[model samples]
Target: MNLLEKGDDKDIEALSGLGIVSDDKSTITKSTIVEVELDLELEETLKKFGLRLESDGCLNWQMDASAHPRNWSVSRRAFNTSVLLALDLYTTAISTSGPSMAQAAMKEMDLGHIKSLIAFSSMYQFGQALGGVVFPPYSECFGRKAVYIATTLIYCLACVLTAEVPTMTGVCVGRFICGIMSAVPSVVVEGSIEDLFNMKSRVWIIFLWACATTAGLVLGPIYGAYISAYCGWKWVLFTGAIVTGVFTLLLLFIRESRPSRLLAQQAARLQHEKGLSYPIHSADATPNLATFSRIALIRPLRLFFTEPIVFVCSLMMAVSWALIYLFAESLPSVYASLGFTGPSTSLAFIPLLLGIPLSILFRIHDQRVLGRRECANLALNPEQKLTGFVIAAPALAVGLWIFAWTVPPAVPHLHWAVSMIGLVLVGFATNEFACTLSGYLADSYTIYASSAFAALAFLRAILAGVFPLFAPRMYSAMGQNLASTVLAAVATCFCGAALLFMKYGKTVRQKSKFAGHSLVVNRATQVKGDNVE
Candidate 1:
């Protein structure tokens, strides 16, 4: 069956109690923020218990518009995103920092096996794989705010275990648990972005979120090396605990944004207070935890194998992430060959910092393009959102090949400036690719965005986890230049794959009942709006 036939897809439409219905507004709008009208019967039923549907179809106590996260002020939204983004940053730092501590932890804990050391890190990714599948459906049923706050607390506790125990086994278990709990921010923050910002406004926020992820990975070694030198590796976990603890406190202020869950909560509250049950829920049953989990875990794999866009983009991200870990493993030796050691090794990552400001610039320009398109009253598709990826894909290939030829074994240690330039190019292009890929997926998938992300994350996260474990040996045997060249070749091929999707993406999405219906609906609405004007 097509994905639209899946019960989830139909129930997704039941949010506003119509299949793929656009909100009834004649204004030319740029954002997906819908001000859905509640059916009068549904509205009056809620009023009997002093509840009403907000503009997004979420139930709110009568006159309590502030209960909806979308209704939050810009400052409030910014604050909430900052807290979630910070938590996401911490996940990357904790994951990548593991290798830096491996030698020290093995020595102190008397662990004889090198595989155990790899386990300390890779197990986190494995756990994240499981969590990525399991947690998103619950968040879908429960709401993002509750999941973020709840999982963050659990994640903090896991950090405490890892910090206090200091044994390989203890740390590995804690790391795995930390990985599972951290999926809250990893998986749900995108939804939070949707809740908080409209389409145009979200561009920079997402750009910064990507910057923070890359910054965490690039900066992890520097900070981990510092703690290992002076304060000890345990302090690394201690610091993460402290940081996440603060963010968890902030997550408490975030309100529920899932319209379905918000309505369910309202229904339950009314039933408890006045002994009344809602009929709206009978036609569109609230997703129970069990059914949601089954779909969440199984659907991603199906989507990965079946959906062309999701599959291709999944490869794009998987290779991109693997290169990151590979770079993390290889760059240290490149700098060591240049006679830079200690924290100065961190300076090698300055090129990766190039991704940050460059991402912001591209985002600004892309938003301008999107704004112009919307103002012209053009019908927008997710294909339009993918313009950045189309540009970045080949650029990323070029950047990778640049790294292939510039670094060691290819030219007996070229100028540090040359290799750094290669790294900078890769970093910037990767960021641009990220901006488009994510926005396109979110726009195309809509109700299925988180699940689709979970699918993409599985490939990328697992690749990142496993690649570092073999990087040292791979670089040793094939040599850095040849190995990097091979990776570059693979990336170049994947870049082509992405372009194929870009050229034919509309046709692929048109075959998808959900996305295709969305396109028709949007075009009809826009045409109606133009006629009204």
Candidate 2:
């Protein structure tokens, strides 16, 4: 007879051992056995949770699961990625939009100093610096889609405020709010890309992301110039709002891409359906307040201060990024001195735009070289990502010097297009440097890549904002040649950072507590295979 059929005092004692209790001796039912089975299943789930479970009973994605973002059809993934790229591009463009229309804004507001004018862009960038540190933890805790929707909606409203509000105070406040909202896309797009694509596919997608960022910087001045020239300066902001509003609507369709969040959601549904009381997710499944504080508030600053690799690389990239803003402030005056007027002055940035695509070609070549090394059974390391940076670093320094020497007063009668060659080189080097350094950080940090990037973003935004404030004054006092020379000298010094890391990167990683273990594991796995053979 079954255990339930043989229910007696001993059987009741056994049921009590399983945490099943009944007071009446003759009232034991079949449902009691089902409850015991569920109890046993829950025990197994708890055991798995203790071991850091990824799956529990029916609450996990199976092989070929249609629910996971990575398993989605290529067309669907591409569509989502495209939407994300567009969002990043437009938001970034807003950072520079004020510079091109500064004169119009200054006239309208009766601003006396160019410093006050620079505040329009600088304030926005300052907001971005803060937002970069503030938003990532929220994304980690809540999910990517929620952050995108909420931020983009506020970003649209901020744009409208900047455009419609009459006071200078109102405009600056709006710009600041816009910057905070825009920072979400800057840092979070990488996480979304991680969700949609695997490592091998990420290279091109990341290159595209780098391209989108640089393109935004280049296009911002061009579009802002023309829009302010014809439709008035207010329309420049109005245009941003209208475009962002459309993107906000598009955001509603994006699936949640954070894997942990998705798993938690799946577990919740199963818990409701099965009526299991035991928790299915692991203890660390959701981010708590402590986790949020550590990641969003403390960790990035700690990494930035303590980690040499993060500090040096981020500092170098920050300076290069700041140069873009410096150019935005200085370029109009530079071109205007050469007799270029109105929106035509913005055309000088076209060469910089051309250089971005060329950098992608170099990136593709670097990938092939790395691919061949992998095919030959060589283990890839983070240092291998430095190949592009090694090439780009010296080019950046040399480009600045070229730009300094080719401009007017240094060479009074030289063609304006000749000066643009330096900008072309600068653009290519800057883009490649950003792409390779970001990849190297990701490879080195692995799971902590987001924190590393947040550190980088924070430093880069601060410098980008500050550099433009001094650009006009620096160019005025030191003259273009000496000012550009000083920048080139700084760039030259940073070139050593790439070389130093390339040679000693493995040694550095070996000593790093937070460094990724994938390379070490790959090396061991390969050795094991050879020994087996």
Candidate 3:
């Protein structure tokens, strides 16, 4: 039947502009007429609520949409990003702070064995592994602001428990809870910042975030040593609680940044304002248990095992993370052997701090080169992002070898400064390796980048947590030189990962079901299909 013929002149006039009616008053298919009518109604409804529909009939941000986070002013976005960055720094700092206060904790609680001391750090990392998998989905379900506030508050309480509780078990329990809450910042903050900036603008912001996180690892032990030495180890926990409490208050000023949550809120407001009871659908429906299970738990684990890129990246990152913890465990003994005592032992870690800035400078230079290449119309791929990693991998192996030989019996007369130089190399390589690989993963996975990263975080946190538990014993039994040599050898073997990926990454991605399609291409295809429809 001809659908437009039944409509009044006003309806036909409206339909004519939409091309649902012909100038010759030709017959229009029922399906086409119905679809146009439906689109018009949706558009009218959205317009009434200060929202709009794109050509694809999907709700989208208006031009310069004030409500869209990306359209927020530079100062506003930077302020919010700074808050998240602070949280990231604090969480990472606390992760390593345990080893700094371990001796004080053991003496105060009457704990036996160095393993018991290491547990303070180990348990927190274990909780982080589980929480990394768990919290990201909840943030997806709720808004990022709510998750950040609630977790920060809980973390404060956990810190208080750790500080105040006299029993070893009580402190360990608090540390574990703290780890779980801290995982939100580690895994979700980057995603939050992503909500604030587009792909082209966010690279430097991510770099800053990486620097803050890595700085926390080096700074934690240094400050924890001084804080524990003077104010007592309990004060270390107390300080964390105080800082977190301040940030929790600051969180109140941060608005909801998650797009789905913001859209849902707008929809609810529209329904209320129009005196309508019918549901207004949003892009992200409220996730149910099954959806949550699939996104949060199942998908990450599946990708981790099935994807070669994921496996290799996760393993390499895991080892790098473990090396940081291993250094925390072994550095004290190494320096003490050379007659350093008290906070002086912490001085050895200062060289590690130099690596982060050096790495950042190197990355800045690499980025400029890449920018020039792109400007010259050179084709860039995910493998191209691994250039820094390729350069850094050999340095890591060499650094480990240098440290292995320069310490104690291997080259007994070698100045401690030379060993410190090796540490400088190690620190630089570790930071570069982690940051570059993270970028590569994000590029390769695109739409599923979060899931891929969650997988990486899960495995990395678990292995990082476990490595410290045995580090003391391993260093003792194997001796510093031999054990470090073994580590260097492992690093040397993994150096091939950079070469392998750079050479064959595209071929590998082609075989993978998940990574076979680029997000940009998929989106373009979807938009084209919508236009055709």
Candidate 4:
């Protein structure tokens, strides 16, 4: 019989002994192979019976069988792969950090050129916003790997240009290009991890990503400091360019993980093997370029209008981000006025170190204790995840207030570090919680995850870009204490929103087209290889 022939239960059961699982679509199109040191005559007999010989000498036979391909399981190996990709995907945050430090370089080149810094910061923000708009569509159309490669390549070139350029305009242009291209890493992180991880494992991985992001924040400034102090400001761009080039070469290992795209590949391979005209195009096989373009362009706009959950959450996340950038800009000047040395200026960001470890611990605690509590029937709802933010918002406000009040020609350098500790503590909380919420949104909104994020990314890039322009003036006008107090108040308002989410998030999610549908609550109900619209 042809290997594709249907078999009965006994035949399937017997084949199961050989390590195959059966499902509704079971069929095999090739001969089964079995090999062993049977007599030559027996081997010949088995061959005549349509069994193929094996290289290892074990008896191998082909039975007509087709089992469901394992493209959707959230196993240990899959989770590990997802985490690694997520880590790689978020390295774009480094690009964002790079420009903030680039400002410090501008100061070294000329202290009075505040207008130049403002122009650079504004361009960076617009580039970031443009990237946010474009990357979502690209990720949806071409899949994550393509966008990753394309953007990283552009970013690398931009870095090289920035490093080599002699004029302020050249550096500004390079910074803008880098900002736009670097967006892929941030946008791709959630989608890539979700492609492999389910809810329980996703939480831990999200935590890992959050901590990793903070590390970028910590390292980027210090990197800029040393480069500007010792090698001149141009090296800041050169060094980042070199690092991105190395990473770009490392992209060889990443594979296409999008379900729809992979399915299309599989379907193409199957058509070639079937030796037939072609299978009717399924949803997975539809190559409507116009449709993809429309979805890519319009979906995020729709999500922004339709989803209040997305709006509030994104705003909160953006506010936190703006504060981080604002503070980052404030630091060199803040510490300089406090009698700190140029080499030691970057070290002022050392307060961020405490936040990184705390995020990891929080992630571990949630996975071990909280996830288990639900798994063991300790909680009725998964909304307990929102609690992490409740802790973060206040810390943000408190830290900003502390850092603001303590900085100056008056306050000691140690006091700045102390306040920074509080600032980073809040950062750890907001950053971690934001990641968790992102996963939650992905689960809740099946078709619009990328779009929803795109909307939020637009908001985030705008705030992050615009806030720094005001950084000098804000600190200049209100002084450190009051400027920070204003930021702290903004964070405090968002804290109340987080509390609201803790109480009624499910209701909010239920209202979302994207968030409600994307969540995978049970293994049986899991949708595999789904394209987040």
Candidate 5:
């Protein structure tokens, strides 16, 4: 009963014709390569690299060949990662920068209220949610390189529209489009990581990515503030355009990282050249766009509802993300009450960055915990990452409570410094929770981690979109302490999810369609001096 068991993914359904091709072989073993007819030139090329054509007609890299992405030179890997990370940061920053211009746009457009802000801010998030539904599976079908180029181009176009559009209506439209393209990094970047990095190395690489993601969010307000102050609101988008447009060109150089699609292409090339037909690897099927849409769009929603782990973790993450946006929208008022006004409010977001440094400390503590417990995360040990979640969970609650009590406009409001301290704690908690939960999902649903995360992205994006719309009203109704307390209670409630998983996650996985009969059970798993069984 693997938890993430999937049926014939519609992602590949449309490609059955091309994938099966004029000659189809369902099973090809290593020993059968001798019987297959291979192009002489292709054969020569393989030999030159000390590789060979496999019976499956795929390019079989030799043990030491540089053709394997894993074996790519250090410079190549570093260059590729840098390009991908840069693209991710630029795209995400564009999505959040809209708020820096919210007031300016409202004035320029002659709109009086904050409601239209949703049209740009939340709509962009809505687009991001929708993007998650489509892009991850597209990566599985078309390869990461194609998806990156296509999505980045669309994102850059959206930035142009936002910058140049004369009407508020047009800017709102551009924001949604930008948000959709922004999702490409969130949904597909993890799949790219899977393509290049091995298990042991993935943790720290993901840590790097997490930091990059937070950096983008941190950049949004500051970058937008400076641009809006100096050059007006429209120029804020132009700044993103200038940055992302450069990154988009850089995207052209990132080589195909999807192993399945790469091998399929190599095999297809050889077959056409030699007029020889052989079985291809099963994973390389390229489903038609319609089937791809059906599966890609539907799968995340299905997983969001049906998978308990996805449901709980997504809820937790949704709450976290929604809170971040809600706080952003409310920042102007909060600090205004404390006598901080205008663009300086953007600097308030700096506290959110403390999470990056604090997370490094947590990662060190987490690694030490895993080592002392002799825990093998590969052995379906979802609980291995739960410690940080546990520690951070209460901190999130306390932080919310503190913010509620300390933020201005309440009778005898506490110092601004005190409220900021609460923000620091929330930021730290958010980083720890997201990293640990994401790592757990990646480990538990190894094959379907993308979909699991897509569910997370989709749900959180929606929450992030919707929550800010009501944040101001909610604050006005309940005041800071009561409103913060309600939010804190919500955060505290989900913390039980981590506790429950810590106790029963193993037993639940024992019965999962994807993780049941664990492939990893053969490996030793121990914690607290006893073998995990």
Candidate 6:
């Protein structure tokens, strides 16, 4: 009954000359692999034909590697190019500026109202959260490249529909579709960097990715301003479509990075060398897709209930994200209160622009000093990364408090600049902490990375959606200072909760089924390195 015993796992190419022992259904042990090593001469021949063997005992033959120099060539240019397009699409299509323009257009059509606008925006976030559940799982089930292409196509289609939508409800539908499709780029950014570099060097790539995302936030308003001013709101959607189309075409050359899938392909080639006509796949090896049961659908939800660390960190980051969106959304009203029209509203993003460079500097410091120290702790213990957030917690609190007190009539443009600088600092630190947390989770629990990330994304989106709907009302009711003070208190509570875990987080991780075993293994590796080779 052993699957391997029946040669179901044998590479089809490897069985080309080897006769089939048994093809009967019951005689075979379902989808199992057969192990067979090729002779040195056969291996050499396979290499000549551009093939590689995997541990699953199969052959994966493909075209020559050099035949696709462009595929393997990973320059900063190519990475940045893809990154820029993805970010532009995300920022231009999803940011407050984009929606505000669409709202204006809808109002001109007599269909705009606060409830509908809020619902539409909330749905966008909800769609994103829902997509986090679906797309990441599907990407892990399939491969990153395929998912990227599919999402890009979907996004393009949605944008076309959005631009031409006749009613507010249709607009909401289009935006929700666009939001769902938008989930892939963030996932792809992490995957792409992992494909290209090792951990030590990945910090820079992360920095670049973060900056690109921030730049989109700044530039979205600027471009949205111009588009909304000159051509109308439809051009906002139109511009996104044109840019996304070009990027989708560029995606024709992207390579896959899913390790299990790549390993399967290699196994197929190894089987080819053994003359097997059909190579067996080892899907059971991957934790993410090993079980195709209903339980798998709710794994992330299970994680939410069980993993306190994931819950706290994701909640903190989600609150911060919502606040960022709230600030961005209200900027127009703030400017209008001060008598600025459409063009000048775009100029307001200059503060955000100035803040980004400053944030990058802080992020660089956090990575070089704090991140290294924490990651090294991971080799010894899992809780070390949580310490890095200690610095971030206060930075966020102070920045928010200062920004709250300094807004409007009391201070001036300089105060606004300082507030932005403060916000950028907190944003950068929060981003760094979240990124490192995710990386640590991935390193410690490699198999559960997609689901864990999906869980975080889902929660963050839910919070982000709800927070924005209440933001204007909260500010109106409580005033900016009081609302910010309240948010600061909430953030402080998170910090306090985070600190408690930082003190005991390793013990906590060591108790969880998902993390405990990995912690021991990683610690063993470090101890082994210290004692032996």
Misplaced by over 4 Å in model 6 are: 1-93, 276-295, 359-388, 409-421, 497-502, 516-533
Q: Give one digit per residue, the lDDT tens place, for model 6 in 1-533.
A: 54334454445433443554444435443343233233456557656645544456554433333222223445633664464346534643355454456445756667544555554466667777887777665666666777777787788888789778746777778878877877667544554454344344444555555556556655666766678788887777887778778777767666676544664665555456655443433332434554644555576677767887667656776676566556556666555545568667656666555544544554465456645554566333334444456666776777677666666644544434555565565555555555456555554443455666677778877766676667678877887667777877776665676577668776666677766653443333221121100
Candidate order by decreasing TM-score:
3, 2, 5, 1, 4, 6
- Tell me the tens digit of each residue's lDDT in model 3 across 161-263: 9878867788779888998898888877766755676543444676677778778877777777888898998888888999999999999998888766776
- lDDT of all predictions: 0.68, 0.75, 0.75, 0.61, 0.70, 0.58
Q: What is the TM-score (0 to 1) of candidate 2?
A: 0.84
Q: What TM-score does structure 6 among the candidates reach? A: 0.76
When 3 and 5 are scored with TM-score, the better candidate is: 3
lDDT of 2 by residue, 187-215 (tens): 77876775666544666777898899889
TM-score of every candidate: 0.82, 0.84, 0.86, 0.78, 0.83, 0.76
**TM-score quality measure for candidate 5:** 0.83
Q: Give lDDT for model 2.
A: 0.75
Look at candidate 2 and tell me the lDDT of residue 166.
54
* Number of colliding residue pairs in each model: 0, 0, 0, 31, 10, 34
Model 4 spans > 4 angstroms off: 1-112, 275-286, 368-370, 373-382, 409-417, 519-533
* Candidate 6 lDDT trough over 10 residues, lowest sum: 524-533
lDDT, model 3: 0.75
